[model samples]
Target: MDIDNIAAKAAAKIDAVRDARVNAVKTAAASSVELQEAVQLLAAAEQKYAKDYQAALRADWTESDLRGFGLDAPSKKAGGRPKGARTRQSKPANDAASEKELIGTTSENW
Candidate 1:
């Protein structure tokens, strides 16, 4: 066979293999909108789940409330109030240990 004939055959096979693999991935992924939906749904669920929890905390906690609550601990709003904004009187205590310890004991808890 001519060199071109041999090379052409090999190239065609390689292209076929590549096309097959691509098709396989596309087919499997396409097989289930539910699967895609489920993955997206999971991502969205996780995102919203975290957001919901944080939102709940934000609803209860206001800005400038990290001091008494401390900075090390997790916070829905404890990142030291948003920048460039004046703090309110109802701000969180800047004392982490003290603020965290005050949980469930403050008049607000009642």
Candidate 2:
């Protein structure tokens, strides 16, 4: 019962949970606008949850040099953490405002 093994088990459990939710949503869906919205919401929630789970997995890493989510662990020498990992650290930001605005400052020269 080491950290990596426990993590793998927990991830398997999480995947099961996600799959159940998706299946349930699919079963409940109808050819209606409301049903469509519900399905979209479920998909968005799953996507967000998956991303958070991956981040957590990375944060508490205790496995081999190779890294990633689920059962796949690729490396460069062997394909791990991917080359653009550092660049992926922050969101694209994609803002046109000045840095001050980004930090919630006013152009009032405060």
User: Could you give candidate 1's per-residue lDDT for residues 57-102 as a string of tens digits?
Assistant: 5687643453346422333332334768886666555775677768
Best by lDDT: 1
lDDT against the true structure, each candidate: 0.67, 0.62
Error of 1 at 97 (Å): 18
Q: Model 2: residues >4 Å from true position, as ranges?
A: 1-31, 61-110
- The TM-scores of all predictions, comma-separated, are 0.33, 0.29
After superposing candidate 1 on the true structure, give the runs of residues whose Cα lies further than 4 Å from its correct spot.
38-110
The CA lDDT at 42 in model 1 is 73
lDDT of 1: 0.67
